[model samples]
Target: MNPRITDHPAVPYERTRRVAFTFEGRTLHGYEGEPVATALHAAGVRVLSRSFKYHRPRGIGLTCGAPSCPNCQLTIDGQYGVPGCATPLRGGESVRRERAWPSADHDLFGVIDRFSPFIRAGFQFRLFRRSPRLAHLAERVMGLIAGGGREVTPDAIARAARPGLGERRTALAVVGAGVAGLAGALAAADAGLEVVLVDQGAEPGGALRAETAPVRTPDGGAAPGFALAAELAARAAAHPAIEVLTGSTALGWYEGGVLPVHTPSGVLTLRPARLLVATGDYDQPLLFPGNDRPGVMVAGAVQRLVNIDHVRPGSRAVVVTRDAYGYAVAAQLCAVGVEIAALVDPRPGERAGADAEASFPSGVAASGVPHLTGHRLREALGRRTVTGVVVEPQEGVDGRGRAVRLDCDVVVVSAGRRPAEELLLQRLYHGDITLDPGPGTALPDGVAVAGGAAGITDPAEALTTGADAGARLARWSPENPALPEISPYPLSPGQAGRPSSSGGTSE
Candidate 1:
């Protein structure tokens, strides 16, 4: 079934020019500028790769926009291990599944999952310990099975041999193009400082580009978050002192303010007097059996697919959340004509108190979707893909509760988020950085952080912090030191039960 969404209210879908690409020797069509993963997903190709050891089927789970997961890594255009989620679809690109024997859909090695118990960690060394010849053969076979991608093509080798490193300097460099980064860039530009704003996304809005709900503006009006992002992006583009670079990945920060950034064109060495890191956060996946199944996905990934890529994740979904963010995601799904089988919140208390109910979108309650409070996800049900889910009430809440089965093709998770602060942490401290440190705590000289990187998830707070950081790095003090006038949506009272301040994690 075609899962492309054409009737989203918040972000209207427009027919764009289509590009034809070859995947596994078969030609497929997708819109230009969309990611290869979404293209494949829209074309009904779910299984992207196989797990390293168990050879279990895997899809583009957490690799939606963030390249943190390896599930969607494919051999693209004869290059090995390219992230399909981040690579935009250009016409005529050759894509192939990696790490799967025969094909991702019908892998012969899938039987390894049935004997996973025998293949425990470091079992390879002991499995054929007695026979040296058997152990050597097993080692070679395992190496071939684990290796992904084919030999590098001659074209790829030629391109790699070309020297294309560039260098530039700026007064201030902001390392994200979200609301916070935009605000920071604008603030720095207003202070007459030359600024460079870099982001890895195809667009400049960051996660705001994925929001389908309308947010309250500063002037008592309401606008969609994507619209607000567009406005900020336009202003940044028009600003004389701000240079906005999209589709650019900031590799890392080195000694003496040296930063190497990778772009579609070439690598650029950037040296800035001061830096502001607003890289934001990643959606933390939940811990459960079958959570890594093909049809299960993080809430942020689903939002990005629906609102940004205009693709429906599935026909029916089971939403498992720990905070109000999940309900918002459910509302967006409902708005786009996806069925919500159930909304499960594992926290104890009455089934969504009055305050929590108020936080939910009116459509959610009006549609009569089931709400299971104090219910935890026991396991996601399905083997190759998610066919349903099993949920049970939290222990010690009341008398023993029986597990309830909810049939769904998709499972949306919004457990919580962990800060994406790799760049900042590398620059400041060698030790582990705290996930939820107070804003602006223990930051080193000539460096600042804002937004989720600084542990501020609220949009309003992120904007304010970003503006402050930009102004501070420029050493400009306005007469009126007040928060910026951009008022985005704030977390509701229902969010009080969000994951602990330490942040959420994946198993």
Candidate 2:
């Protein structure tokens, strides 16, 4: 469903050709050292590592190669570390599975699973208060041990990795290649604005790139959303004023429209007259029994694996959802031979799935896709990897329902998305860095929100939002300027795990 080879530039064509990479001394082939994460996954190395608190088992959570997770530490390149999810692999590269005191598979700390029963959600806090000395020490040690942090071999990869970005320039830079960022880029290009669209991937389309098959535009229109996205990318790429950074990931935003974007070559401190953030949402993992496992993945991750990567998450998948995105993705997967064991819609009262056939083809398109209303995951049965899921039926919720077991190798958690608002919390509206909910509630200045980040999601609004952000940035003037408005995605009344400080920093 990813818009037939996005008309936009893709990784600009690999120059070094393919090379061999070693995972645990086992040689595998890929586009010469692409990312260590990608190679391992293709080789069916599912359990990319293990867990943290309970040392339960873990795998490549996402493809970003965010380095190895301490929760599931390992030894890569002769060094003990976390697997860099996004790190590319080459002929000589070596990737080793975890080798802890006991082992990543069966860690001595894993006994925490047994104590998990007594340790409620925040058991550490209670223990700290009751037995401050040992509890506090244990918590600190545990926290440090579970830092889940990773260090990357920047020098090695940078020196060897080869990618190209022909000379191009833009007045404004848009971070995040999702729906909103793409929208901002398109609009800015249309208004004769010099725009630079950057994405972490090898393409331009943002989350729009993540989705499978074009669904209804915001309105019931026939815009050919995918085509539109590709066409716009093409148009912008061809436009003299617009430049696209396909593999460049924006690291962070700085004062005066300066963005430090990470490119394969080096850290690029992009200086622009204006900056459009447009960084969209990240899948929030749902809290449930046995939530941490190798086979359990975010809904967006499943969609990416199937559609973009052309990889199957599992032969059969059970999509647990409270959102339409999940349903649509599942439908697409089902269409392409991937079976949808069932579509678990948590809220039975919600009629989102009622018109499934309209949005996506029913029966074969979503065959065996029974929309289980009020269906909640009681537990997932898996010893090492996911084996199946357990469902508990809610009476009167589905009128027709009961406890059922669905056999599947994968569990897609489609809970919801939360804007990566760490930067937002780093700034303040009035006091420059005061705490309290951000009133701006949109992409902040020098940090324009677009795509899902701007809340311009899906078919229709994606285009408009991108264009709007671009236009605004292009038309920006000091003499008679416009003040920016940013809205946080999770701007609900109550949402958090900690407290905020006076400097707009969340603790």
Candidate 3:
């Protein structure tokens, strides 16, 4: 029950239906639509998988529920390579950690961790060169031993995949249904242009889905941010022109401006006259020696666990950050009875020898939480999972800088975010296009960027950017009639229903 957040203040526990599953041969209970990782984490199962080379235990990295990460990859229902964190739990499913013999907890391949240094860098080419054939044999043997999960059965592949959704035509296609994407879809639809909103989540509202803080509304009023997310999502869902495709992703650009979208049902090749990309940023991992431990996760991951999944990350935690985001994570944790061990901040203007800062922002104002200035996380201490963290004072010390160790099971890192620029970069590399990384830059003729992917983090600003892009697309498209310009609601500080402006790089 310590890891289970049943009565959390920020998020309500409303599971769809009770279901049973087997994890590593043990029967476990979970909700039908919830992520398998959420149920496992709530049941006090931290180290879900292991790294390939070192076989080091891993829980969830950034915990974005993205299939791109390896933390959630496991063997599911006799099929190898499944995303435990993103996949919904179906009753009576069997899940096992892949790439480990015996089990992920007691893996036979774990001995490689001790001998990693000897065989890490080009060791295969260096040592296994008796003959080309012998070397090839050795490589094959090693690959079979330390490579990946069991072979994916052909029957599973045939049954799992269905036919594609075929080509879809629209006036505008907005990728990534975060705040910016959602706003852009609504704005374009309101402007009388057909919109296809595609997202990689089960529902709309990227981080807004997990946010618990109250935000400003266009009316300069405040309300719970999640409530605002719900309203905006509801409106988008009911919009006539807006085709909200949740649990889907815009894979990449194809020839003839066709964008391949992968959804749970099937694949969709969307051909929109104008494209607005609003893929948001992912939380960046902090720089520390033991940052990759099992219990170490980014602040956003903690928010997702607590707010979205209603799972307590850990009993005691340490937040390492340089901005206000860390404090917000602490507040969310505190709401669920998780004790914040320390807030290690290493920003400029914070004195190295000072005790605690004079004041903190209202969003991160935790009375009992220890706010330590000029302190940076040096290392996380533990063999398998995080047990404690070592913090050291920043530079400009009077030669009296000493490292301090704080005991904690989890380390929630808030080291800023990096834009999701894979699709953008892919376009730049292959397509003949020049993109300037700035507040507003001209893109290719038919493609435009908005929101976090365009380097805008403020919710209201992102909305405005989306609306601007939508209006521009509507005006440019010859098929759509010239409608009035769409505008988002105006907002003031602390107004509810709109997210506060935060981090994003230019362009």
Candidate 4:
């Protein structure tokens, strides 16, 4: 049986309220609120979907829920495409794998992998086309092969699309309800500006929902971690001026701050005077052989599975990381009753020795769990799910060191994070702003960014930056006579832009 977490005394719902769902005509049971992808993983059902052409095996890579990777794309409720990791499993929900014939587990189209060399790019057309009639036939054949799911014709799209509701106007709109988005909303409301906060999750607080432990506060005191995410989420929900929309996703932005937000009920057109994109970050995966296995997961997803969903990822775990974030993950795994085989540090000996134990909590530190410094994960060994990790010393002689294999069912990787800047990038593309904004420039008016989305990882820094942005927007003036001018979100390492010159003063 898959290792399930049912030992947390603080959270009772972790073990109860099982909800059943159907996938590919097979009935499966999962928790009431957990993602369908997590439930599928717990049932050992990997390879959710196949690639368009080659049909290579795709398993959960990051489990990011953002669906940054195509590993977990599947059809839900007659929809031909959806991110299974991000899509929640409702009782009796029907899910099916897309782009795979017969089944995702045993796809007949997988034979295309053998002929991938002949089908590289448009080589097949050149190879098969002879005369005008033959070329037309070859084009038809290629189209049939390339199309994975049902044709998405204009008529089909119209049938599937939901009707748009009327528009709503707000003083300020925040795209995400994560750390930065929540902070921005609360600050803007506290500063007397009407605000609207939108998030994709069923609830607000973003990553804060997964953070259970206390973190160091700004003043060096202990705070309910995530800079009090629970407290902030509660306050935002109850704030008079702040309108919170859970399970709402900001689709896109247009000129004049016209935003199309996708809600479960329908589309909401938001004409906010100001917009803030604080969507936060997605976890980066480690690069190694067998990294795409079923049991391999990103550190953030593992935390969410344990703390938020109350699911144990595995019985034995190996954490491989380059930073202090990995230590925290190991501690969490240990607390959830998962055996931490070892903590592998890939940094050089000097840096690893100095900081390997810095982030470890007392429970993990005092347990005498083996800490392997300066060791790089050479490969993950297993046919399907992860079974063990082979590690070697980074500074060993002649690039060949004694390899140590740590047996573990799960491998949690915490390398770093990349900014979730898709929305920001899309908005920037519409304006005449160049991709490379010069260093230290102010930003365009009516737009602001904060938190992890702005590359600020420290929770304290994210909270402060978000509050600053909200406060500045509240006191915005044509001629800034009071507050020192705040810099824009960093375009590059040091590059920034001025606020939009045409932004009207706040009412």
Residue 158 accuracy (lDDT) in model 1: 71
| All candidates in order of lDDT, best leading | 1, 3, 4, 2
Instruction: List model 4 lDDT by residue over 203-225, tens digit each.
Output: 78777666655544446776645
Highest TM-score model number: 3
lDDT (0-100) at residue 288 of candidate 2?
78
- Tens-place lDDT digits, model 3, residues 1-507: 367677877666686788999988799998888888888877777778877667778787454533268876777877776777778887898888777778787778888888877876667777766677877877777766754434777877886886888988888998887777877788779989889988888888887777776655567876565666777789999999898998887888766778999888888888888888877766777777877888899877788788888878888999887655566677678778888898887865344112223223442344667666767888999987899999988776322358888999999987766666567666666754554464323355656677667555566666668767777776765444343332222111111121123321211
Give the TM-score of each candidate. Answer: 0.88, 0.76, 0.89, 0.85
For each candidate in the order shown, give its overall lDDT on alpha carbons.
Answer: 0.76, 0.58, 0.72, 0.71
Tens digit of per-residue lDDT, candidate 2, span 46-99: 676655566566765532212113433456665556345545455676667652
State model 3's lDDT.
0.72
lDDT tens digits, residue span 1-507, model 1: 359887678787686789999999899999998999989999998888887878888887554544367888888877877888888997889899988778888889889899988888878679878888988888778867875424788997776553557789888889999888988889989999999999998888888877755554546676677787788889999999998888898988877778888877788899987788888776778899998899899888888899889899999999988776777787788878899999888776554433246445364457688877788899988888899999998886642468999999899998777667778656546532333243333443566777766556666556667777788777732333343422122111112123222121110
Better of 2 and 3 by lDDT: 3
Model 1 poorest 10 in a row by lDDT: 487-496
What is the TM-score of candidate 2?
0.76
lDDT value, residue 160 of candidate 3: 81
Error of 2 at 4 (Å): 18
